[model samples]
Target: MKKLALNYVDTFKGLSKEVWWLALITLINRAGTMVIPFLSIYLNKNLGFTKEQVGTVMVCFGLGSLVGSWLGGILTDKIGYYKVMVGSLVLTGILFFGLQFLETYTQFCLGIFIVMTVGDIFRPAVFTALNAYSKEENKTRSLTLIRLAINLGFSVGPAVGGTIIVAFSYTGLFWVDAITCIVAGILLLKVLHPKKAKVLDTHENKKGKSVLTDIPYLMFFGCMVMFSFIFVQLMSTLPLFYEEYYHLPENVIGFILMTNGALIFIFEMPLVKYFENKKIQHLNSVIIGVLLTALGFAVLLYTASMYASILIGMVLLTFGEMVGFPFSNAFAVKRAKRGNFGAYMGLYSMAFSIAHIGGHKFGLESIKAYGFLQTWQFMAIIGAITVVFLFFLKRIIQKEK
Candidate 1:
């Protein structure tokens, strides 16, 4: 038992101070995302916006995310991850704090856009830095640890936000999130001060290849978009489904999401390690994950009375997410050009932005037409379709390898 414990400690010892600091900052940064899980609720209940209006307003957030991903890539390459992350976090924190004072719908929409743009700018840069800092052999574990931190933060954020909403107001959640972001930004500024490496510029010149022309990287990016398109439904439509169809309370819905994050925190690392050495293809992992997620959605369609059944479905979906998420980052890092990590991570972030936008638009329309259960069924079918696309993506990635 002691040997086992010592070995575990040694495994963590391989991580550098920079990685640890970055992970801590990421946890603090993401802990402030309390408002996101309840944004639709806030719009409907607190701000008196219709569901349709909320969906339309969300489009601005997606647009900002898309722009931020592209800009982060270019700027990270030029200025370094440290500066980009710090600046983005500080700017975004200010916007989030300002959201508490907004009254008009237009102002709320603009605030969301500004917050998303600045928040997303640090995302790709931070992930790129993590990849750069990790040893090749420990890279997957490092990424897994980061995911675990994110899930841990998310678990706390929503539960706390739910309580705060009940106790005070949605504005309280916004203020908390803003303060967390500011603290995270300050910590990151102190810890990450490395000079910009010129290796990517040299590689681009030597290979005479445009950064955007990497075919495998593009395929991976496309895969991220497809998966995120299916997954974003959980946040956008799933809560509404619970409220309208299941007749569940807001706090109950919040608890369910907390469960999802908690499961990821507990199981993601072990699952990633299990698949790390296996010859199972990256595309295969994606297919399996998406299929499980889709099946979970399908199962939810059959359960009308039992909340336990809904919890079972959540288990399946969370397991699927665990399998899919870490591997996607690993695959992207593997396929990325040496020293151009930021650009590749940015492309991945862009895929997620596109997916969220598409999912929100489709989910809102589908829920209106078919109702919640049938809409989830439709999403399940879309997830299965993504699995089919992965077969083609696998061949492309293998050829590049």
Candidate 2:
């Protein structure tokens, strides 16, 4: 047992120093993001906003993220990943600190939008840097580790954030989140110094050929937008479902979400590695994931009891999430041109932002019009159709290949 443990330690030691720093940065940044899971709660409870108004405000945050993703790619191409990430983190931290003073609904919405936009700008730069740094053989594992760190933060951050909110106020939560972002920014700037490469100078090269010209990449992003539209329901609609139907307490909801995060942290890496070598057609993984996620929603719709059924549904959702996310990233990376990796990643992140806005706007209104179960049933149908569309799309891309 001791020898086995030693071997594991040695294996970790063999990884690139950059991977370790990336994972640490991911964890810290994600810890700061804990505020998101409870943002709806804070707005409704503390700020006295209606559900529709909250949804509108959240869309502003999504809009900021959409713009940030594009700007991050451009900046990364010009100044390199490390500088973009450092700048993003520092600005985000300042914005987050400023959030404590926001009392009015408009102020809250605007503050969150600015903070999310500046903070999320680091995503594409960071992902591109990790992809560039990792060996082909270790790329999946490295990405998985980064994701695990994110989930680890997800697990801890919500539970802690929820506890703080319960004990103190939303202001305290904002302060903690802001401090963590600043600390993470400092650590990243000190540890990871990504040198600018001439290869990534998009301006000096072809002025006509932009990153958006890549069709397969655009299709992939389109698929992700659809996927996020379905997935974001978990955040926007599911809590309302639990509250209305089961009368589940907020703390219980937090625990359930923490369970999802814990499961992802435990299983995401191993599953990614296991599927790494399979030539299973990237779209197939996506299709399967979508189908599973749809099934999770169906289960939730039928769930009469609270704990056990919800847990089962969550497991399925997490499993689907694990399969879907990394493959989407890998597919994007595979299709991206060498110098424009950050741009591709940025485009990819924009899909999620778009989906978040679409989901919140659509999901809430749909539930109001159709009723929760019927609305979810419609979502499941949409998810299945999306998978079918992607399957055909994959065939076309494969034929081109």
Candidate 3:
């Protein structure tokens, strides 16, 4: 048992110093991610908004994220990712401070939009930096490290968020969240220099420069949109379901949400590495990953409100997350073809926006009209459909290759 534990520890031993800083940066940034997870709750419980209104407001966030992704992609190509990432963190933190005062619905919506707009631009830039900073052999592992850092910090966020909300109310959530973002920005500025970063543009060409003409990349982009449409429900609807249907308390909800991080922290890198070393196909990983996500939501149906049920669902979802997302990112980087890695990442990041529009809007309406059970069922069905579509899509991409 001791020897086995030592080997597990060694799995994380060989990452680049840049990768370590990136992970630390991600951990710091994500540790304060209390606002978004509880945004629906804040609107509902604190401000007395209806679910429909919350959904509408949330879509503003999605629209902002869409524009940000495009901007990040373009700006990364021009000024490099360092400036974009640092600016996003600092500016978004300032916006979060502004959020403390907005009480009216329209003001809150506009605030949400602005915050996410500046905040989300960081996504593609971070991935671009990650790709630049990592070795090609460690590409997928570096991506996994991003998720790993996120989940590790997230596990702390919800638990701390729960405590903050209890002691200070939702206002505390925003304040703490802002502090973390600003601190992360300072850390980034201090630790990572432009000269030290690795920008991978292995096979640049006239054709590689323009993602607009890349059909395979476009098809994959579509797949990512569809995937996010279903997967993002975990963020958009799952929390509401816990509050409205399950009647879970903030701390309990935090604990449940924390399970996602805990599982990934314990299992993902090791298991994902194990599967990759065994020569498993990337497509197979995605298929199982999507299916497991479907299963996660499905668990909610039979075991609604049960503590064990939520845990079960989280395990499935985390397993799916572990197997799938890194491969999906690997696929995007694979398609980069050289100089346009940031552009590819930006395009991929837009899927989060697509997911927000599709999942939040569609889900709120479904819950209002059909009920939570049916809504989750609908999301699961969408996941299943995406699997079939991905199967076909993978075949086409492979044939083209």
User: Which residue pairs overlap in candidate 3's backbone?
Assistant: none
Can you write out model 2's per-residue Cα lDDT over 26-139, one digit (the tens) per residue? 898898777888988888888889988888788888888998998888787788788888889888877887887888988887888888789878989887777766765666
**What does candidate 1's lDDT look like per residue over 106-164, in tens digits?**
98888788778878988788877776677676677787788877877877787788998
Best by lDDT: 3
How accurate locally is residue 276 in candidate 2, as Cα lDDT from 0 to 100?
A: 62
Q: Per-residue lDDT tens digits of candidate 3, residues 153-230? A: 866777789889999998888888999999999999988976665445333445456787787678777777777777
Q: Tell how far residue 31 is off in model 1, in angstroms.
A: 1.3
Each candidate: what lDDT? 0.78, 0.78, 0.82
User: Model 3, which residues run further than 4 Å from truth?
Assistant: 40-52, 165-175, 196-207, 236-256, 298-313
Supply the global lDDT for candidate 2. Answer: 0.78
TM-score of each: 0.86, 0.87, 0.86
Candidate 1 deviation (Cα RMSD): 3.6
Candidate 2 clashing pairs, residues 3+ apart or interchain: none
How close is each model in CA RMSD to the real structure?
Answer: 3.6, 3.7, 3.2
TM-score of 2: 0.87
